[model samples]
Target: MKNDSGAVAAVKARANIAEIVGRYVTLRPVGSRLVGPCPFHQETKGSFNVHPDKGFFHCFGCQASGDVIDFFCRINGLEFREGLERLAAEVGVDLGRARSDPRAAAKKRERDACLAMHELADRYFRHLLGRDEGRVAREYLERRGVSAEMIERFSLGVSPEGWQGLQTVLRGRGFDDDSAIIAGLLTQGKNGRTWDRFRGRLMFPIRDGGGRVIAFGGRVMGEGDPKYLNSAETPIYTKGQHLYGLYEARPVMAKTRRALLSEGYLDVITLHQFGYGEACGVLGTAMTHEQAKRLSGFAPRVDLVFDGDAPGRKAALRAAQMLLTLGGACRVVPLPDGEDVDSLLHAQGRDGFEACLERAEDGLNFCLRMVRESYAPREIVAWAGEFLGGLADEGLRALFIPRVASGLGLAEAELRRLLSRPAKRPAPGPRPGETAAPRQPAWELAPRDAQILSFVVRRPDYAAHLAGAGAGELLGNADARLFFARLAGLVSDEAEARLTEPETAFWAKAQMEPPVSDEDAAAFFEELCVFLHEARESDRRRSVMDAIRLAQQRGDSEEALRLLGELQALSGRGDE
Candidate 1:
């Protein structure tokens, strides 16, 4: 199936590849391509090459090669569809109208409407914050050491006390109750009347990586039952999919390749104000795999700053486990018994916070300490098994298994065997915590097959030459055969969607190699085809010999002679 061709093509056509990539990497023109140090990884030689004419980039250092959309997605931690939508908006392309499918178009329209409603609501909240009604919230922010600059930077606002305050504003702006409610800006009561969802609270606009307001998180200015109120899941926002200040933190994160993962909006803002610009907060929820993955794009190292209380330590431990399992380096910044990032920063300033960071411990070491403290010696094995079982990558699991085994005084093999069994429900009672692991390729191909597949993936134009070459038949690995079969008639771009995750990774990596000339590709293709043909014949001869031996073992003279003659004919044809 084709992608949203009209929308994708329009966005790509309007996008200047060099200009877009230059925002992240400093580039200088080199022949037809622009060259720069790769933003995806550290390199001093400027191996990242961007071809303006082709509208694609390739990093010789990291093997990252993709079009403008791919670059935007990779750099910003966005999915393909989300990246496309953001780019489409940038290019002034109405994706809904560009789509041919009526149903899909309608859905896109609803999504767009929700986003517009959110923007409108954000403005309304900001307007309320500057007015007389916002006096109480403004005073509260000032008391908490929040500056006017930060208020503007984070788009901090106040929702008026009146239930209909925001409802009226939205209605006046031409937003219906249904649309406002769907955008998580308003709520419907039991009496069937709609009202502002966030009232008498300080508003923090939560944005996506593109800096568009997608949702809001509200904090009570004074005493309240539920201290914090966040926007419910809507068309444009999911609770665990975004970090509060990521949009603002991205620039610093890109430079440092590190992030400060905090647990509150004020914490993130405070960190930034204190020169820790590479800081963001979870949206009032536990850290998630999606959020971890998003952070991994900008920062390879994450410093988790949580409260010093028991619950905060527990949270830090959990977050660190997730970061480690996701192949991210993490450190836990420990605070005093009653301190948090915001409180500590306000009390002691940047110097004090830096001291805490200096005292941060490695993630795995913290995990081991927590587990040892929380669990008894008898329970260590069970805990180790559960943690190791949660890890999907056997190699990563193996690396950790030794350390865990050493900590628990158990054999590494014993822990491996425990993980090998089917996962069981956690034993009854309170547990220390849970952790997750990263993923790796599940299968590998023979060297010869891999070389052939890599060539075809990069030079898809030559796939036609393999039409009658029996290359697929000679592939011993099932993954290689399947990839070859599906990729035979597809273009390089189209092949990505059809491939498995591992296959797509292989395909992308192969594209990083130096482009082969047509003559070189032809010669390589010819040599591989000959090898496959010879291998195929050798297999046929081996099978015939096996059959002849089987017949002879059965003491059937006539059958053995017949098989021998067939084998001789097969060998004769191969020799010819």
Candidate 2:
């Protein structure tokens, strides 16, 4: 099931344990070994000890002892087989697993075909830039500060305007139109015709984490409706799932454990050109749970550098929320109004850019700032609940609770009570010349609901034990439901398989609170289950009350009486 041979052994032999571990942790030489903060588990004091000479490392605090292979597995959340493949790729070793597994052979063939098409398209587009037709695109890039070296290093390309320009080349090279379309290089028209997907545009190849081109984002050279266009979702490419310059940003992100996220292709290029190699861009979309989770894998934190426009600020807030939810660290660097990273870097250079980073605020504080500006004093309690309820650490939550209460002008006990319940949404406002509708209170998950789910995510062993006892069946939160469904798939004895992006994001959010140890698991698990049951019953009671009110409003006495009986039974009260 794994690559046991020439590649894996060579990767291990060539890999320096200290260098590899240093990518995620800052290691200082301590006697014969290097010690740094452990990333696999949460800790303040650095107890993770690494023996570079022996090619093995051990975390004294958490007892996470591992060799290079095991270290990669834990740090990257990969199984042994996947980690081997990634390490092999890193060290430039051929995996040669296709010969052993038919499934692997089939997957390899499909991916290779797609890669070949991308390579050909990249070359064709670059060659097009050399033609007279690309003069406009070239001028545009040069104006945007893209140098000749950058164009080559980034494999920048230009798509010609003709309908069948790229189609002609692919067909001549024995590649079918179907293959081109599947690879996201060609588009078919409504009249049973196919042509180039990108035309008269500057093309930016979107590479995957492994540095292979999977898709393209095309920006129009002149006036156009879309301004920028991206390739459609294909088997190999999902825009929100990959960052623009991650392939180039990998080494730098690894070394710094930080990434600078921007909004456009040129922003990333310009930043990298000016010695900011840790910069990358979101692929033609808002920051997603998947994107946040993916970037967090390489770096501990991502500093968002977006334009200071209303839309840009809104996007930053969304990104901050997603990162906060995922339990990943993030900082927001507010740029001047009407200034983007590309323009700012070109005008001010690295010094100016570093200045902005200096003023950056933590994700939580940035989000809280936004809430304070928009929400009323009374509305702040529910908003704070939504914000602070995601923090997994009780001690940290304890510290923030009073601060938040003081800021909102509420008592700590009152704020804590508000957080223990589901947050309420504001009612819709009245339309012009119309009376306002009465707002109905909506039901949401209680803080206890989040606590139980977080506990399960942090302790998969607990999840497995709870599932055996039918604990998952009692969960009502949509997010919690999705998590338990995925957890069921990874309940095997040796289950170290990675969860999907959304699941991973939820897991990260759950990570805010530390996990209960095996010694305390029984007591803690019982308490959480009791709290969940109580929450569910509370929701059920609310539903019954809503039903009674609706029935009575409709003048249906029979129905109202039946609901009242059910409610009384639930409340353990006899009808008089």
Candidate 3:
């Protein structure tokens, strides 16, 4: 881990933050900093600021701030390690010694190999789609109105009817049977013979947030038992962790801050073809919390474009509940019965699709309507209780409670009481190998504390003076105290690496703030010292008053009188 940290610091030191950020945001010089519209959210004004000298970016509008690694991770939907590796590669840094542990190094190599195999498999599938053997699959796609451009964009491919087609390709490419099987490109039979996992089907390559091919989903082109077959859980890809078409849709979604979430692969492709570039699909599984969170990172609002049948409606309801609980805005776009995004777009084109979107209903309202229509009164209450219980935010829960109550024909008070009852716990505790979530540090600071910290951050020379005045004791927030303690001795640039997750945004924003003048900083420091002294005295006075009341209540008159005398002496000193 020490070596890893060293590697991370080396990468950060070498990588140009502005150059990386400029890829996503068109930045213009603003004094010493660069300014651009925030890629994290939709904004007209250039509130996102990049400090090339400091190697960090901050958005005043959304308060999104971090270093280059943070920017890449957030924008690409990657984890810290993945982002570090990717950036390290880009910056031409060697991480070989950083991953010195043989076991960890081996694991990394295995994941890399799996990813490489998937890429090869993707290329093979695409090649086959252009070959003469792919005539059937190509015809099916043509009839479905899938254009050549879309086919290329999505890397659409086909597996021939024979089992050894992909197997032969992988073997020739030097991928062994075990590795190919692990990558989900080949399956072994009971007779101990390995064959292609996706035969006679249209293949959709699944990629990670960084656009690395990791897995595939294959839909049968002709009559078959299972219409769709997806890659099993692989080292590089999980079932529900990644969404289809997200890599293609990310840029548009970032600009729009909205996404059209549908069910099937064709639905997503069709949506993208029809100019809804901010469209993605779930990977053949029910919407998970991880997927919802990933989508919310790029787009605050998601429009559910699932099929208009009963099962699709049910899926939409579940997805809407999850998104609402996560504090994401969403709408349910209703297509005609038996119509999906693909069928609707093809039959009536963009105008029809736009009309359906125009009729989209709020996610919560959709949930309520569905509950009211499908569930009986008792069931509706249970459903509402379950839904409300899942909401961790009390304010958000309160806002939705009234609507749920009204829709269910129950009094708000009754609904509240029902929710108040002890409900079944979803999980008894953290599962094996999973630790309980850490308690978050209080990130908010009181106004005075914020002012004090802000001044100290801008003018680090005054930190010693503020500390000498017992400013740390007067600070209310734990995060503020920790931040001051950690960064008081270091320069602002040095403080960036020391920040905790809770402190990163604040630190970045403080760095981007206008620098304080020497005179202004001195005056503010003195004023802050005096304020802290007065605040400390006030607190002491209040404590003594409380003691005096307790003494009087206990009939300890002498003690009470003595305390009063001390209080009088203090007041006289203040007056002097």
Clashes of each: 0, 2, 0
In angstroms, give how far residue 502 of model 3 lies from its true place: 2.7
Report RMSD (Å) for each prediction in the order shown. 6.9, 14.0, 8.5
- Candidate 3 lDDT over 48-120, as tens digits, reads 9998987788888667787888888887766566677889998998966545456756767788889888888
Across 215-235, the per-residue lDDT of candidate 1 in tens digits comes to 888999789958999888887
C-alpha TM-score for every candidate: 0.75, 0.64, 0.74
Which pairs of residues clash in candidate 3, taking residues 3 or more apart in a chain or in different chains?
none
Point to the candidate with the largest TM-score. Answer: 1
Model 1 segments more than 4 A misplaced: 1-10, 13-65, 74-79, 91-96, 389-399, 409-413, 416-503, 513-576
State how far residue 435 of model 2 sits from its true place (Å). Answer: 39
* lDDT of all predictions: 0.78, 0.74, 0.81
